[model samples]
Target: MARWGWASFLLRRLTGTFVVVVLLSVGVFGLLYLAPGSIQQTLLGTRPATPETIAAIQARYHLNDPVAVQYLRWLGGAVSGDLGVSIRTGMPVSGMLGGRLSLTLALTGYGTLLAALVGIPLGIVGALRQGRTADRLVVTAGVVGLSAPPFAAGLLLLVVFTGDLGWFPGYGAGEGFADTLWHLTLPAVALAAGAVGLLIRFTRAALVRELDQDYVVFARARGLGAPLVLWYAMRNSLVPILTATGLIVTGMLVGTVLVEVTFALPGLGSLLVDSVTFKDVPVVQALALLLTLLIAAVNLLVDLGYSAVDPRVRLGGRTS
Candidate 1:
């Protein structure tokens, strides 16, 4: 891989990421502006409010400003690391979000890890076995996993493990490291269910494709042992499998939101849902921007990883 090629690829990805973030910020602010609700009423929560009180609240948050002006104000504050206070709790949005960041990362990381552990081997076996009964079973399980949504999976896990079997707690992020891992077990599994299926299918398909390539044909014809030939196939299949992995990991953000809500975890996903329901625009916008950044960062990493995995992208002077 050439140094100049890597520089150009990185520069392009950074440019794209910046554009996406800018668009997301504008879209988020605009949608909230058009969102039907009274922030004053939401803040007061059924309390009686005089005309004077309402006017004061509006002025305090500069709600009277033009929508574009308001967006610019918010954007400025966001750039300075002050995302403003939550309308619902009057707490700094950054601080509030920071407290819950670990659990969200943990959920996402654990889910991805679990998906890789379960999916990769099954996918390889399926590809190797091809049309056998084992392959059929693996394919069938993948289909079923893909068909089930995270929320439904969470509920079912809760009922069987937490409700009936009493194997795990139903909700709450546990206190310490061990407890938290235990608590997050079900949520992670629920979040990863669909990803597992996706990985299984993607990995199987990638391996199958690699195994049929000319390289594999030559390797076998050269009298390479079965293990050595399969190793060649596995090594070549990494790029596609990595592509699937990147997608699964990013897609887990959405799944994390659903699973968090279903499991009642105090993470960004539940916070987002609650904030939106209560018309907490600051929290919602902050979360939206943060999530967008996270996704963009993951995509950038995946792009870099592709070059590393198969230096052809860099050496060939092509950005894929």
Candidate 2:
């Protein structure tokens, strides 16, 4: 691999980050505006507030200003790490998010790792053993995993493992690491299933395409072992797989919300859902923004990762 120059790479990554942040801010602002009711109702009570109280709340939240002004104010505050106070909890939004963010991150991060570990190998094996029994079995498993909804899987797992067998706690983060792992096992598998299957399919397809490429045939003609040639081919084939995985990872974060709700886990997903339901604007905004940032960061990393793996991708006009 060519040396990836730090200065140029950072510049490229920062540029992309800037663009994504602007788009995210715009999107969030639009969603807030499109929320049911006027800014007063969104930031204040539905009961007719005394004019003085309404004015005070508007001033407090910057709602009295023009949309542009309000956005700029929020943007400034956001840059300063102030997401404002949660209307529902009467606490700082950042503190509340910080409390729950780790749980969601743990669940999603570990589940994604498990998915990648299982899916990539399965895909490689299935592709190599195409038309054989092994391929059939792996493909069948992928199909089932892909087709099953996570919430349904969660429910079924709860019934079989927790309800029938009485083996594991159905919900809550347990007291210790071992207990936590036990509780997380079902939800993690439920969250990972669809993503794992998608990655497998993508990897298989990419591998198939890569094997047909002229370079792969040339490598084979040069007397490379099947495994060696396939490994090289897999690396080249992984661009699409990497891209697909990035998207699936982001999608899993969304799915985590549903999984959390179903399993009664107190992760950021559940917190966000609760905030939305309770009309806790600050919490809702903070959670949404945090998720957006996480997704954006992943996408940026994916771009950099692609440039690292493939010489064809450029960073700062340099073939890296």
Candidate 3:
């Protein structure tokens, strides 16, 4: 595609993503507003909800303002890098999120890497073997992985690895890089199980289709080795794999709440759960917005990856 075409595509996608973020913010804010109980109630804890106390709390936090005005103020603050103080902790939401965000990102990164490393090769082997015993075994494993929920899988891992065998630490993000990796092992495996299953299935299907194409057959017929031919076929089949990977990574990031809770990890997912339980609207809003932004950014990267992987995929035109 031409430079102008690529730029136009990016502009359109960015504009659409921005609109989505705005709508998501509004929806989250509205839901919080409609939730039962006032922020003052949460702030007061066991203290009596006296009129003077309520009035003072309202004035202090502008809680009595119109819903639209409150949202606007919050949005303006977010734009200025101020996500407001947490009602539960009385600390800046950004500060509370900083370290936790890094931990979550690390968990997601490690899980995704593990999934890709295991899934892609197994898929290729399964596809090449077709109906052989190895293929059947891979298929069965994939089915089992897909059938099990992350929490269930996590518990199973916890039982076997932490309870019986005593292999890895059961919880926490740990202290340093090596310790963190050690602690994250089981959680990452549990988090990646479903993704691995999906990738195995997707990769096998894509490779099967690619191998049936005339180009693959011709390449093999030309006396190219099996490895070279398979390599070429894999390249041709990458688009679907890339798409699945992006979705898997996003799901892992957003769905880490259960895994984090299971492992007692202090990540964004756990933070989100805590914020919701405590009715900390500012923290909840900020986290929700951050997740939405992450999804949008990943989608944009996937679109760009499409053009990179497939030469025929032009930005603003039919595949050439």
Candidate 4:
């Protein structure tokens, strides 16, 4: 593959990503616009929706404009890094998102790391032991993990660790790195449970296929130890695992909504929920766009990782 080819491939992907973000923004904006109930109603609370109050509110937020015009204005502002102020709090959307985004990112990042660390080894062990009792146990555990909801898992953990054992705090993002880690431990585990199950299944399946390949059999026949042969096979099987990992990370970001709500953590998930409940259009729109961009960026990195891990996987159209 030529350098120009690789460049073209990356350029194409970047263009596609931009298109996806645009479409996502349009969809989010449309959905919020079409949702029932007027912003005036949300602002008035229990008060009567008088004609004067409705007109005043509509003019104040430019809600009297056509939906398309409003969307275009918001999109233009987003491009310029001005996401507007929250209707509910009068705070800048960007400023409100900053601290919450950091907390959500931290929770998801640690959860992804923990999932990979625990899942890969479990997968290897299950693959090596095929049909044994250990493999059966792992399979069962994976099934349960996949079937259980994150919030339910979180509640169970809270009951066990915080309720019964009194081991870890049940809520709040604690101060400092160490304290935060302590506080996040249960939430991370709950958030990661489903992802760990998915990784274990994907890794086990990939390894099993790799181990049956000619190269793996040849290496084993040459008197290489089981560990060495498995290592070689694992390298070849990484593409699928990497794909699964990217998806898991994306899911973690989405799943943080439920996990954060369950744990009562001060993260973007909680903020998003509150924003929606209060009909804070600016805050909701900003968070939705940010999450979409984050997912797209992760997927872009995963595509680049393919070429890095396997020389045969040319980012260009032609493979060597």
Candidate 5:
């Protein structure tokens, strides 16, 4: 039964991912079609564009094809690892993404690590010391973190660390691992601050509930030490915290776009914004597709993770 249930869940996730991919592809292609002017004319410009040259360009790019046909052609190319040539740079979309994907991945990785490192502990402290001085301090810090905007945080850091103190690079992904980390520190902190706040709030709330459960009382009655009680209680409380953390991480993926642009970092978010402004359709489409896939994958992973954190969730999912 467990095996069958797991299989069913996997199948459902796969199906949903496929549907989302198709919809995203259609939407991106539709945007290109709906954009002003002809695709061929837009690319070749008005520098004496002959019909012969226009026809040749259309034939080269399948622009003469119907909208559905063009979409299918693009979809077919996408399946075969061809994301189409960039309308602006005449470079392969995959090449462009491959070059910048690492920077974005590094930023997200560092930011998420910082968030978890800071958030989990603060949450634990808040939960353990509920209604005390420590709790109040944690809550106040969480509120501040939640209220801080990533761009504002980034700008402030830039002013203090770069402008005033003359420490760290103001913008750009610096060369070398050490330099890159130094460059990423401020942006990652800015991005993760809110996540830390959210995690603390979630953890405190969840742990408070768990601490009041009958099993917690049983543990206390059995003469368990405060440390043991806290540990056991926290393990159960983490389920909801995990759920909220997953959501925060998902949001961070999109939220990092603005910060990336503001800092002029050579990440996927920056690339997407620049491409869109320049009307680089292929690049924009590919990035959008990749981001959609990434978000869907993250959500799927979070769903899978929930079962491991909470047996009740697994049983509930199976029964439902």
Candidate 6:
């Protein structure tokens, strides 16, 4: 890689982000308009729209314009932080989302942290003890985790921990930082479970592949200890693990909906559900864009994280 690799990579990512956002914005707006009774009926309520009234409404919201024009117009406003007002409550979409942002972030953040903490280590251990009972046990546990989807796992956690054991509270996001974290523990665990399982398998497979490479054999032949050789294998295996982690993070963001509903947390996912239920066009559009940007941003970071993943990888990756 050249020194300009980082710039080239970042520029490429940004351009892709721009294209995706444009297409997504167009699709979301167009599809919403096409959906029967999604916005028109919701906006009109039970009363029929007279020609004059229909014209006025269309003019006001730019509904009469072509989709491309409408998208560009909306895009202009969006770049400046104006997401428009929520049709349901007349609240600024940005403000509404901001209010619930922290809790949702906390939940997803905690879940990702937990998944990494639990998954990576177990994966390492499994790889080291491949074909052993411990490896089989780890694989079994991962299957169990993946089998119990977030909602079911959440419910079970609520019943056993909150109901029987009385170890944690059942609902609400709680108040204050400490209280919030305390409240989110079970939900986070439930959210992290599937991700943990995925990471375990991904990490194990990656490490195993890396360990079998000629480089690892050469290192061993050079008299480096097992620990050092294993460390090198682990380091080389990070690209896949990081890729999986990025996906997990994005998945957690979207996956929060069911978990929030189950745990009664007021996050973006729940907000999105309610917005869609009420046919709040502005809120839904804003959220769709937000989630897309977040996912794109994570992928960009992961891409940047490649050679940058381990500085030693810079020869082939960015930051050379």
Against the unseen true structure, what C-alpha lDDT does each candidate score? 0.86, 0.82, 0.86, 0.86, 0.83, 0.85
lDDT of 3 by residue, 1-320 (tens): 46666677668777888898899889866756576776678655556899998998788768878878988987888878888788788899889988688999999999999999998888998999999999999998888877878888899999999999999899888898899999999999998899999899999999999999999889888999998998889998999999989998898988699999999999999999998887777788889888888888888888778777875554655554
Per-residue lDDT of candidate 6, residues 1-320 (tens digit)? 46565566667777988898778877766655765764555555445778787776677678877877878888888888998888788789999999988888889999999999999999998999999999999999888877878888999999999999999989998888899899999999999999999999999999988988999999999999999998888888999999989989999999899999888888998999998887777888889888888887888788778757676444434233
Model 6 residue pairs with clashes: none
Among these predictions, the greatest TM-score belongs to 3
**Could you tell which candidate, 4 or 5, scores higher by lDDT?**
4
Can you give the TM-score per candidate against the true fold? 0.92, 0.91, 0.93, 0.92, 0.91, 0.92
Model 1 scores a TM of: 0.92
- Count steric clashes of candidate 3: 0
Off by over 4 Å in 3: 38-47
Comparing candidate 2 with candidate 5, which one achieves the higher lDDT? 5
**What tens-digit string does per-residue lDDT give for candidate 5 at 138-208?**
99999999999888888888899889998777899899999999999888988898888998898888888
Query: What digit string (tens of lDDT, one per residue) describes model 2 on residues 57-156?
Result: 8789777578888888887887798989887778888888888888888888878887899999999888888889998988898899899888888899
Instruction: Report the C-alpha displacement of residue 308, candidate 1, in angstroms.
Output: 1.3
Error of 3 at 193 (Å): 0.8
Q: Which whole-number lDDT from 0 to 100 does residue 227 have in model 5?
A: 89
Mark the regions of model 5 whose C-alpha exceeds 4 Å error after superposition: 41-50, 315-320
Model 1's alpha-carbon lDDT is 0.86
lDDT of 4 by residue, 2-73 (tens): 676677777877898899999999987775556567656764545578899888877866787888898898
Model 5 residue 262 lDDT?
Answer: 75
C-alpha RMSD for every candidate: 2.3, 2.5, 1.9, 2.1, 2.2, 2.3
Measured with C-alpha atoms, the lDDT of residue 117 in candidate 2 is 90
